[model samples]
Target: MSTRPILALISGANRGIGLAIATGLARQGAHVLVGCRDLSKGETACKALRAEGLQVRPVELDTTSTASVTRLAERIQQSYGYLDSLVNNAGIGVDDDPTLTTADRLQRTMSVNVLGPILLTDAMVPLLEASGRGRIVNVSSELASFGLRADPDWAFADFAMPIYQASKAALNSLTLSYARQLRDKGIKVNSICPGYTATEATNYAGNRTPDQAAVVAIRYALLNGDGPTGTFANDHGELPW
Candidate 1:
């Protein structure tokens, strides 16, 4: 086994599903980096985990900003030298308005959900490669799956937010691209839908708790070198594209 301590960065980790994912990794002995747009909230989140005696720290990161994403990579490179895992858990849901224009919604959703992860991963992949056993977990959603959406009987059929859904589909595509490109370097990249979990994003209305939603994502992060890559899955198993 690699002797180097595992270092994992989870973006938007100040609360909700991101916090849950970060907490789960910390519990497993990974040095968790909580990435948040808000400094105070990030610190607060990390402090809570630290109180639990988990190796956790806060890193200010606005995934949509190039400068911010660059700073994140610089800080990690300077502090830990390399990254073992990167969970792109930062996302937004602003396309729910019935009157929202498609272009406007797509621009906003893609900025954080699609473009941000792409840039961050591109910048961080070198560090992950240095670890020799790298993992990139993209926090996607079932709404992104075209197959599921095509079914009129699908449970979430009524929840139509095209921008957010399309953004995740783009994210899933990026996951596969990264998995293929980094396969020879021993990096695993996969997208996962945590299901409809109760979090600030969902106003905590869903039946699933954040911890429950984070389970599969944590599992993917801890995968061995031999584990499958380029997969889109959830708690149960593989999901339709």
Candidate 2:
């Protein structure tokens, strides 16, 4: 009804899956806000997107920083007054090695992966509520699937990154909680795994490309009034919680 185009904010969108999602949404006529902690990188991404005649702008955001998160909320509220979509694409995963116990490593990992998205989503709820219909897509991992991990024969059952896995599980739970909280308000929130994409996080070991992985997130983000919420799914279908 607003005719302002679908306004979307994607964090950590400078590169990888985040950038791909931004591009996909923009190509579909959404005015995207590329949220990046590194302003230069954000600008670089936006420049490329702009060249493609896509509607997108770079916004300074660092999910781990309370000030940055709060500032982004304020900026969006003041600028657009409503946010139609939000993609919590900014996340970090560290090696599960003997160096994990350091105070710095533990706190930083959790702060980026878990606490950051939680705070960012909480801060942006008002903007999301302003939209008649809002969609929230949390970029979670299939690795967080407890149902799959419990099975000895699951493909990734042998893989282990305890802290990262736990953080994503927590993320999936929060996505459901937020979905329920905002259900009546018409804000759909869902957890989506981009599959094992070849990004910097995986050191390019993954078989899937960022563009290939962006499909499901784009689908979830652009769902209409009757789409499902509180779901954990991927390109395939609903994943076991």
Candidate 3:
């Protein structure tokens, strides 16, 4: 067995898809760091995983806060020294309301869904570089697809969450930029549309379970250096940009 223990960091992992991904990675023998804004929830999640004989630990992280991101970086540096994979899974949704929407709503949505990942990735680059087989997986959505957005025949047109859609689109662009910059550094960065997953965030409207989404994410996380970069995928195949 490869003794190079895979160190993975998953944000917003207290519950939902983030927690599911953490559990899946831990099951595969990866040392998982679960980042959550709530300490109690984080501890609970850690305990649940530990009970299953999985290696997991809770780390305090609020992606919207720069100070929190810096502190998380320092904590990881002190404990693990390096990270093999990073799953930028934290995100939020804005209620569909064109009349009530304000700049604050857009800002908050973008800050959490888009900017947060950028800051966290920037903070963890050194650790990823040190790993030599680094993988950065941004949990994007099908709503981010420009082709889908432009096509009236697309199913997503039936449900219009403009703020959330725009944020994911921005995240996809960020993934591309990062993948390009890190290409020479041996870090493979890619975006994934986990499909419509059933979670609290989605109010259980989705047909797929969180575990199903986690499988796709873990697959990307464990991919070799030769794997595709700057691409998007679901359970079936690659998606259109």
Sorted by TM-score (best first), the order is 2, 1, 3
Q: How far in Å is the alpha carbon of 111 misplaced in model 3?
A: 0.7
Tens digits of lDDT, candidate 1, 1-241: 5675689999999999999999999999899899999989988888878889999899999988989999989988998788999999999988875676867778888999999999889889989998888999999999999888889999988887777888899999999899999999899999999998888888888899999999999999989867899999999999988
TM-score of each: 0.96, 0.96, 0.95
What TM-score does candidate 3 reach? 0.95
Question: What is candidate 3's lDDT per residue for 13-86, written digit by digit as tens?
Answer: 99999999999999999999999999899999899789989999999999989999999999889987889999
What is candidate 2's lDDT per residue for 1-241, written digit by digit as tens? 5567899999899999999999999999999999998999999889978998999999999998899999989989888899999999999887454666656566777898889888889998888889888899999999999999989999999998777888899999999899999998889999999999899888899999999999999999999987999999999899999
**Best candidate per lDDT, number?**
2
Q: Where in model 2 is the C-alpha error above 4 Å?
A: 97-103
**How many steric overlaps does candidate 3 have?**
0
Question: lDDT order of candidates, best first?
Answer: 2, 1, 3
Q: Tell how far residue 95 is off in model 3, in angstroms.
A: 3.0
Please report how far candidate 2 places residue 84 from its true position, in Å: 0.5
For model 1, state the Cα shift of residue 38 in Å. Answer: 1.2
Per candidate, the number of residue pairs that clash is 0, 0, 0
Evaluate all candidate structures by whole-model CA lDDT and list the values in order.
Answer: 0.91, 0.91, 0.90
